[model samples]
Target: MPDPSTLTPVDRSGGVRMADVSQKSDSARTAVAFGRIHLGEEAFQRVRDHDINKGDVLTTAQIAGIMGAKETSKLIPLCHDVMINGVEVDFTFNEEKEAIDIRAFTKSFGVTGVEMEALTAVSVAALTIYDMCKSVTKDIRIGDVHLRAKTGGQSGNWKSEVSAEEPAQN
Candidate 1:
């Protein structure tokens, strides 16, 4: 890993500042992140049965995920205003844990990577789940947000596929 001193901090003045993307080349960058929202059995069933009070959990969360990617700059203090080309979110069930696995894939034709956007997507989606199910289950948690893989940019392609045994928590 590069030394911390060698890397430039975003806010040199102890405030907020966006990255300088001007010198970087525009590439077809893509990143995939995975996260989990640990809903109790009751909450999971409520989502499965389409009985959540606010609305459809999966659909609404999916839309929120996409919107999250687009609006990442507005949320994260130092993230760049990226031009995202695509964003996809998938949710599945973990029978053993009785929870949901959310995977977000984000693509951009820009100078910076969209890993943050991907992570933000998962975060917002999980939050949406908690929001929609709050009435039914107050114990819902949004957890284990991570980047599974990232492609393009100076670092090239990188991947980290966590084992199934080490489940995400939230």
Candidate 2:
């Protein structure tokens, strides 16, 4: 979520506004977000064994994720148009949870932070996975999407303090 304190230009009736990053100095910024798609037994096995007929699920999802990050500003109304420098989307199979763990890392050199990009990356990736595996079963669940960490901007650096809830990913 965008920091509430970073928002500005509240109206008299308490209407919220987007962050005005115009005056903020340009700096190297990065963010990481995570989410998962619970594909159940059959879908999970098919994805893990690379037997899905919709081509390589993970590879296609990764590409879609990067594209989604690039278009974050267009998709979200309050988001600023930041020039993203890099984006990485990765996935891992969780046998115990019958899920695919997704990780998205976004980098930028801009006045605004890229946490929204990172979040869009993971969400789009998870949605892509659901699309790919929906043929096997429509009983997929996407949840637990959250920002793991962010660096740069006025916030400096921040990370999720709930270490125990972090992904068991690389």
TM for every model, in the order presented, reads 0.89, 0.89
Report the poorest 10 consecutive residues by lDDT, candidate 2. 161-170
Local accuracy of candidate 2 as per-residue lDDT tens digits, 5-50: 5447454455767667778999999999999899999999999889
Q: Look at candidate 1 and give me any clashing residue pairs.
A: 141-170, 143-170
Best-matching candidate per lDDT: 2
Whole-model lDDT, model 2:
0.90
In angstroms, give how far residue 56 of model 1 lies from its true place.
0.9
lDDT of 1 by residue, 67-91 (tens): 9999998998877899999999989
Worst 10 residues of 1 by lDDT: 4-13
* Alpha-carbon shift of residue 2 in model 2 (angstroms): 15
